[model samples]
Target chain A: MKYRRSGRLVDMTNYFLSHPHQQIPLTYFSEAYKSAKSSISEDLAIIKEVFEVRNVGTLETAAGASGGVTFIPRVDIYATGNLIDQLCERLEDPERLLPGGYIYMMDVIGDPLLTQDLGRIFASRFRSAKVDAVMTMATKGIPLAYAVAAHLNVPVSIVRHEHRITEGSIVSINYVSGSKKRIQTMSLARRSLKPNSNVLIIDDFMKAGGTIRGMMDLVQEFQSNVAGVGVLTESIHEEEKLVNEYVSLTKLTEMNVKSREIKVERGNLFDDVYQI
Target chain B: MKYRRSGRLVDMTNYFLSHPHQQIPLTYFSEAYKSAKSSISEDLAIIKEVFEVRNVGTLETAAGASGGVTFIPRVDIYATGNLIDQLCERLEDPERLLPGGYIYMMDVIGDPLLTQDLGRIFASRFRSAKVDAVMTMATKGIPLAYAVAAHLNVPVSIVRHEHRITEGSIVSINYVSGSKKRIQTMSLARRSLKPNSNVLIIDDFMKAGGTIRGMMDLVQEFQSNVAGVGVLTESIHEEEKLVNEYVSLTKLTEMNVKSREIKVERGNLFDDVYQI
Candidate 1:
C-alpha cells in the first residue's frame, strides 16, 4: 500500500534495518508502495542522509535495472570504542571468575543488545568482499555467529561437538585442542554448507585458538574457505598463538584466580580495521 | 548532539525498534538529543502513530516519576496469519523430512529475519503479564529462545543435556523423554536464574513435550515459575502428550520417510490465542 512520506520513511527504515547486505531492486519498492521510481529514489535519498549522518549504516545504491540498494551495517569508531570499554568493564567483574579461571561468558553472549553491536563490529571488518555463510561451534558460539549472519544476510552453519539424530549424514573431524592439547571431534551436517563457499568464523571466547583452528579445519572439509575469524575476547594468556589471522574485540590482560581481580584491554578491532 | 524533528524522529524510531519492551525516560532523550522534553514527547507521538497504525506495536507512556515510553511489539492477526502460512510452507518441504520422524529445523531457526518475527509474535502474546527471563534447552533451542529473549528484553537461561565445566556449579535433574519414553537428565547453571523469578520457555520443536516438561521441572528446581511454554512446531504423530498447556506455531500432520512427503497445518497459535 502507498503511504505518505512520513509513513514511508518509517517503513523504509524498518525494512533496511531488518534486511542488511542484500540488494533490493528499486522496482520492488516502487511497485509495492504504488509509487513512481523517481519518488522511491527521492525517498531513498532522504533515508540515506539520516542513515549516514546518524552513523546507522551505509546505503549503497546501484544505477540500472539490475541496480538496487544494499545496507552495509557499520558502527562508528567512537561508538565501537565506547561499547568495548563497557564490555571490558563487565568482563572484569570479579564474580565472573569461575573456580578454574574460566570467565562466565554466557551472560554476555546471551544478551541480544550487546551481541547485536558485537556482531556488527565484526561484520564491518570481515570479508565484506564476499561471505557465503557464518560458521561457529555449537552452544556458546551460536549467538555471536547468528548475530553476524543476520547482519550479513547469510546462513549460519553450527558444527556440533556431539552428534544428534536430527543432523543426517554428518562430516566429523578430530582436531587438537591447543590449550589442553587433547584431541576432540567436531561434526557438521553434510548438507549444511555448500562447497567452495566462503565462511566467516566467530566465537564467544578464544584462549589458545584450539576451537577456532578446529573450525578452520572443518571449513576445509566442506571445501569452503575461511574468509575471516573474529572473537569477542582473546586471551593473552596464550603467548604463542596457534592461529595468526584473527581480530578480537577484547583481550584478557590478567586474571588473578587467587584474588579474583581481572584486567581486560581493548582488542585488535581498531588496529585491524582503521589502521594500515 | 541536537537534531531537527526529522532527524530526531529517525533516531527515536531506531532506538525504540532495537530496545523493545524497555522503558526509556523522556528526559534521557531530551538530554542526549538536546531537545526539550516536550519536543521529545512530540516526536514519540508521531512514532506511536506510525507504529500503532502499522500494527508494529503499542507505545505506552507512564505518567509521573519513573515515567517513560515503552515499545510493546505486536503483530496484527492478519500479519500473524501470513507469517504462519509462510512458515508452514517451509516446514512442509519434503526435503525437511528426516529419518525417524524428525524435521530438519536448523535452516529455519538460523534465519534471523524469520526468527525476529517469530520472537515478536511470541512476545506479543506473553507481554500482558510479567516475565523475568526466557528459558530453553541447549543446542537446537538456543537460537529460538535467544530471539524471544531479545524481544522480551530478558536474559535467556540455557539448560544443557550435560553439565559443562564452563557453566560452573549446576543443578541437574532427570525426566522422561516422552517420545522415547526413556529417562534423561538436564542441568542448568546455578546462577543463571534467580529464585522465584517468572520464566517463559521456548523451544524449536516438540512432539510429546518431554523436553518442555523437563524444562518446567528444572525451573521448579530453581524455585522459579513457568510463565508460559511456546514451541515452533509440534508433531501429531504422538497419541498423547506429556504436557498440556503450550502454544505452537505449526503442526506437522504427516511425515512419510519412505516417499519423502510432508504435510504441515496451522498450529495452535491462533486457535489458542484469538479463539479463546
Candidate 2:
C-alpha cells in the first residue's frame, strides 16, 4: 500500500510541474493515487519540498476539509520574454503566412500552452498595476485578453464583431479594422464595464491600431479609465497613432512571405518584470 | 512593531479569505504592513487559526527565505462545477456572438481565479490518468490547457499550424480542418514529444472533431499515447467520429441564428469530479 502511494506521489509531482498556477483538491489526488487521503497528504508534503528546492514554483495547499493544492509558474522575465521573441519570429515568416494583405496567424493563436505562458508573463508584469478589468475586441484578441486578465485576477470584457443573443442591451461603435475604406462594428454590453473602471486593453496583433482605438472609444463611453495596453505582436513600420504607455512583447518587421524570411526583436516589458 | 504586526495579521487573514488560493511572498505582505519579518511570523500564526475556524483555505508558510504564504481555493466539486455551468450559460447567448457562429468567451478564459478554479476542478477529474503532458493546438486552447496543466504540473506540447524557425526541424502533416474540402498543414517539432508519452488532449472548442483528430494524428507521429480528451464547449449537433470517452464542460446546440437563440447544457464531467 505504501509503495503504491509513493508511486502516485511521483506521478502527482510530475503533473504539478507542468502546470504552475492552478490548485487541485486533495481528494482528487487521493483518488488518482488510489490511496487513502492521509497517504496522499504525505506524498504532497514531499512534492512540495521538491518545488521549494527548484525555485520554479510552489505547491500551495488549502487546508481544512475542503481545500486542495495548486502550483504557480515562477519563470522570471528573462526566460519568458525569450519565448515571446521566439513566437514573434515564427509569425514574421511572410511567405509562409500572408494569403492576401492580411497576416495568417490563426495557427499561432490556436496554440494553447504558448498563449498560456505568454499570459502568465504578462500577469507578472501587471501584478503591481491596480487594474479593474481586461478589455479586448472579438475573435483573436479574446485569447490574449483572457491570458492577461487571468494573471491580473481581473474580469475580462470582450467587445463583439456583431451583436449576439447573450448581450441583453448593447452599445455599438464602428472602427476601421484594416483601412479607412473598410469599417467594422465593435459592440459591448451596456453592463459589461463598471463606471470609472481602470481598464487594461490587450490584443492578439496590431497593424493600423484602429480596432484598439475603437476599443478605447468604447471605454470612454463608460466613463472608465485606461490603465495600460499590451499587444502580442505589432507591425514595426506602421506608426502608432495614439501612444498611451503601451508595451509589446515582440516587434514584427520586414517580412517576405515567399522567401520565408522574418525578423523579430524583444521588448522592454520583460526587463521591467525581471528587475522587479 | 509587535502591535502593528498583530493588527496586520488580522487584516491579512481577511484579505486571504477573499483572495483564496493565492501565493504572496512574506516580504511582500510584510512590506505592505511596514513590519519586521519576525513580527510578521507571529501574526501569521494568529491568522492561521482564523483560517482554521473559518474552513475556507489554509495559510501555509514555507520556512526558507524564499518561502511565503499561499492560499488554496478549496471548495467542494459541486460549487466548482456549478460556476463552470454558469460560465457556459454566459457563453450560450446566440445574439451576443458573431456571424461566424462563434461565441466570444475570451472573457471567462482570462479571469485568473476562475481559470485556476476550473483548472483545479478539471485536473481533479483526471488526477488518476498519469498524463505525461498536456497538449493543445493553439491560441484559444492555451488558457484552459495551461490551467489543467498547471494543476497537474506537466509540460504543455503545442502543435503548430505551420513549421517555423523556433520549432527547429519539424514533422509536418496534412489534414482537412473543416468540411474535408481544404487540406490544411499542421506541424510538430521532431524532438518536442518524448516517445510513448501519456498525453492529455485539450481544446477550447470541438465542432466537427477534425482539429482533435488532427491533434491525435500528431500525437501518434511522436509515438505518444493519448490518455484522454477534454474541451470547454462541445457542439451538440456535431457528430463524433472518433471520441467516446471525452469530457466537455458544456454542450451548445439548437442554434437559431435568425432569432439569436441557443441552448447550453452542463456536461457530466463535473459529476464525475464531484463523485469523489
Candidate 3:
C-alpha cells in the first residue's frame, strides 16, 4: 500500500519513537510505505527537525548501503530540571519520612509517567556509553531498570537477594550492607548476561552504595564491564560511599525522623563532572 | 513558533504515541503549533486515518466543551497472533526447562520489547475495563505490570512477599499457594493504593491462581475493587483453578521434567469468553 507524505510522516514518527537506538534500513520503510527512498529521507529530515525543536530526541542517520536511522531519546536540560524539581518537591513531603529515616518512595517509583521521564533523563545521560543490558536489584529498582532498558533498547538483568529455584544455575556474591554494615547476599542467573557485555546499573535509592558495589562485583564475575551507574535518589551520609562514581537524579540531604523533616535537592546530574 | 502541516504531523504523532490515553485539547495543539483549530483538526484527521489504517491505534475525539482527543493503543488480531506465536515458540524451547519443571522465563520477561508487547496485548484486552492501577507481585511481574500501566497511562501497585521498612504501614494477607499448597504472606503499602480504586491485577505466570487471589484480597483490604486479572502464562493442572474469571495470553498444556519437553499454546485470549 502506498502512503501519502502526511501519512508517512505520522507513521515514521511513531516508528522512530517506539524503536529507539535501532538502526532501520531505508529499504524497510521504502517497502513498508511503498514510497521512494528520497521521499523517506525527506520524511526523516522533517521528523528529525521537529524532534530537535521539540526537545524530544535526535535522529542519527548513516549514509551507506548498511546505513539507516537511529533515534536516540533525550531530554533537554530545562525539561530535566523541571522534572527533577517536581521530584524533589514530592520527596520533600514529611509524610514520606518513615520511622527509620527511610522514605516511602514506592508510590513515586510506581508512577509510570514519572519513571518513564526519569528513564529518559538517565538514557540521555548515558547516551554515549555502551550499555548492552541494564542491571538492578529485584524489588524496588525493577521498574526504573526496565524503563531505562526500554529507551536503550536492551534487556534487563535483575539481581535478586535470594536465589530462586526458577533461575536455574546462578552466581551469588556476599557484600556488606552500606547502612547497617551487615553481610548480605546477591545473586543473578548465569544466563541473564553475556561475558564482556557493558552493563548500566540503576537503582531506586543509594546510600552507602553497597548494593551498587555488589552489582559491580557481580558484573566482574561474569567478565563484564560496568558502563555507568545511575540512581533515582541518594541519601547524604557521613559515612564514605562504597562506590566512587555514579549519577543520581535526586539527593536527600537531610531526613529527621523525630522532627518529620525531609530535605531533597537535585542530584549530581548537572554537576561539572557530567557537563550536560 | 508556527509549524507547517508536515512538522505538526510529526510532532502530534510523537505526542500521541508517548501520551497514550491522555486527552489533549485541540487548543493545546493549535496554540503550540500556532495553527488554526481547523488546521489542527485536519492534522488530527490525517493522523487518525493513518493510525487506524496501519493498526497503530485509534484516536478518540470528543466534541463540544471539555472535548479532546485520546489515543487508545491497540494491536490488530494478526499482529497479536504473530506475537503470541513467537512467545509460545520461545517458551517451548527445551533449554528453558529447569530441574523442577519450572520454566526459565527470566530472559523472556526481562526483555523490554517483549514485555512491552505483552503489555500492549493486555492493555488492549482490558482497554474497555475501568482500570485505575495495574497490580502485580514483586520480582517477576513488575515489568509486565509497568508495561501495561504505561499503555493505560496508570500507576502500578506492587505487592511483595516480604514487607520492607520503607513500605510503612502495609496491609498484609496470608494465602495458600496453589502449586505447593504452602501458606504465604503478601503485603502492600497502605498509601500505594487509594480507597475505592479499580485495580487490574497482572502476573507473569499463574499455576492455580493463588497469588492473584491473594492480591485481590489485599486490594479489597484497602477498600478497592479488582477490575480485572491478567497473566502472561497459565499452567494446566489436574487440580481445579482457585479463580475462574481471568485472561491468559498463553497456556502451558504439558511439561515433562524427565523428557525435558514443554508444550505451550494460545491462552483464552481468543476464546468465546474474551471475543477478542
Candidate 4:
C-alpha cells in the first residue's frame, strides 16, 4: 500500500523502536512505502538526529549496496534519575511495609511501564558487559528480566523452582534460598543457553544474595560466564553480603514492621562512573 | 536541550512509541526542539503517514492549545499471519515434543522479540476491549502478559500459586489446574487492580481452558469484567474446552510422542473478523 510521507515517518519510527539493534536496508523502507531511496535516507537522517539529541538512541548508517541503518538505544541520565527518585518515593509508603521487616513491592513488579524504565536503567549500566542473554529466577523477576532483554535485544532464560514437561531436557541445581536459608532446587532448560555464552542475571529483590550466588553457580554449570548482575532493589540492611559486582536501581535501608515505616534510597546504579 | 528539526522528529517518534495512548501537547515538542509549531505539525504529518502505511499504529493529532498527539498501537494482518506461521514452524520442531504428548515451548515464550509480536497480535485483536489491565497466571505466562500490557499501556496483574511477603494483602482463589484435573490455588494482591476493571487475560498455553475460566471467576470476585481472553497457543486435541470467547495465535493440532512430531496451525486470531 502506498503511504503519505507523514504516515511513513510514524510507521518507520515505530519500526525502528521495536527492531532496535537491527540493520534495515534503506531499500526496504523505500519499497514498503513505494518511495525513492533518497526520501528514505532523508527520513532516516531526521530520525537519527532526533534520537541522538533526545538520548533515545544512536542511529548508525552504512553506505553502499548493503547500506542500512541500525538503531542503538540509550538512556538519558536525567530521565533515569527522575524514574529512580519517583520509585523511591513510591516504595517509602507505609502500607508497603509488611510484617517481619519486609516490604511489599509486587505492585511495582506488575507494572509494565515501570519495569520498562527499570530495565533500561539496568541495560544502561551493563551496556559494556557484552551480555549475550539475561537470566533470572522464576516468579517476580521474569518481567524485569524480559524487560532488560527487550532493551538489549536478547533472550531471557528463566530458572524455575520445579521442572515442567514443556522445557524438554533440563539442568537442575541445588541452591540456598536466600530468605528461607534452606536448600532449594532451581532448574533451567538444557537448550536455554549455549555453553561459553555471557549472561546477565536480573532479580526483583535481593536480600542476602544467596540466590544470586546460586544463579552464578548455575551459569558455571552451563559453561557460561556471569557477565553482570542486576537487582531492581537490594536490602542494604543485611549485615553480610554473599554477592558482589552487581548493580541495583534502589536500596532498602530499613523497614520497621511494627511501626509500618520504611527507608529507601538510590541503589548502586548511581555510584558507578556513569554519565548523568 | 534544543534540537534540529530532524532531531525533534526522532525524539518525538520515540516519545510517542514509549508513551502510547497518552497525549502530549504540540507546544511541548516545539519548546523542546526550539522549533515553530508549524514545523512540529509538519513532522507529525510525516510520522502519521508512515505509521498508517506500515500499519504500525495510528497517530491521532488534536488541534487547538490543548490538542496534542496520541499513538495507538495496531497490527498488520499480513505481518501477524507471517509471525504466526513462523512460530508454528518453530513449535513443530521434533525436540519440542515430550512424552505423554506434551509440547516443550519454553524457547518461544522466553523470546522477547517474538513475544513483542505476539503481544501486538493480542493487542490488535482486543483493541476495542478497553482493557484496563492484563492478567495472567504466574510462571511462563507472566512475560506474555507483561508484553500485552506494554502494548496496551497498562499494568499487568499476575496471579501466583504461592504467596510472598512482599505482596501485602491478597485475595486467594481455588480452581482446577486444567490439564492436571487437580485443585490448585491462585492469589493476587488486592490493590493490583481496581473494581469494575476491564481485564484482558493472556496465557502462554491452554489445554482444558479451566485456568482461564478460573481467572474469569476471579475477575468477578473483584467486580471486574473479562474484556477478552487470549492465549499464545491452544491444544486442539483436548476432549473439551471449558472456556469460550477467547482468541489464540496458534493451535497445537496434534502431537505424536512415538514419532516425535508435532502439528501446529494458526489459532483463533485468524478466526475473528480480522482484515487481511
TM-score for each prediction?
A: 0.95, 0.53, 0.98, 0.93
* lDDT of every predicted structure (CA atoms): 0.85, 0.66, 0.91, 0.83
* Number of the top TM-score candidate: 3
By the TM-score metric, which is better: model 1 or model 4?
1
> Candidate 2 vs candidate 4: which has greater lDDT?
4
Per-residue accuracy of model 4 over A131-193 as CA lDDT, tens digit each: 898999989899999988988888899998888776778999999867678998888999998
Per residue, candidate 3 scores C-alpha lDDT tens digits across B147-261 of 9999999999999999888889988999999888999999998999999999999999999889988998888998999999999999887799988899999999999988888
By lDDT, who's the top model here? 3
The number of the candidate with the highest DockQ is 3
Models, CA RMSD each: 2.0, 12.5, 1.2, 2.7
Candidate 4: regions farther than 4 A off: A1-12, A23-45, A60-69, B1-5, B30-39, B61-68
Tens-digit lDDT track for model 1 on B51-114? 8878788899998999999999887888889889988998888877778899888888877778
**Which stretches of candidate 1 lie above 4 Å from their native place?**
A36-39, A273-276, B36-39, B273-276
DockQ of each: 0.63, 0.09, 0.86, 0.63
Writing each residue's lDDT as its tens digit, candidate 2 over B30-55 gives 67777787877776665564444332
lDDT accuracy of residue B148 in candidate 4: 87
- Local error of candidate 1 at residue A238 (angstroms): 4.0
Interface Cα RMSD of candidate 2:
12.4
lDDT of candidate model 3 versus the reference: 0.91
Better model by TM-score: candidate 3 vs candidate 4: 3
Q: Which runs of model 3 end up more than 4 angstroms from their true locations?
A: A273-275, B273-275
* Candidate numbers, best lDDT first, in rank order: 3, 1, 4, 2
Off by over 4 Å in 2: A1-96, A100-113, A178-181, A238-244, A268-276, B1-110, B127-146, B149-267, B270-276
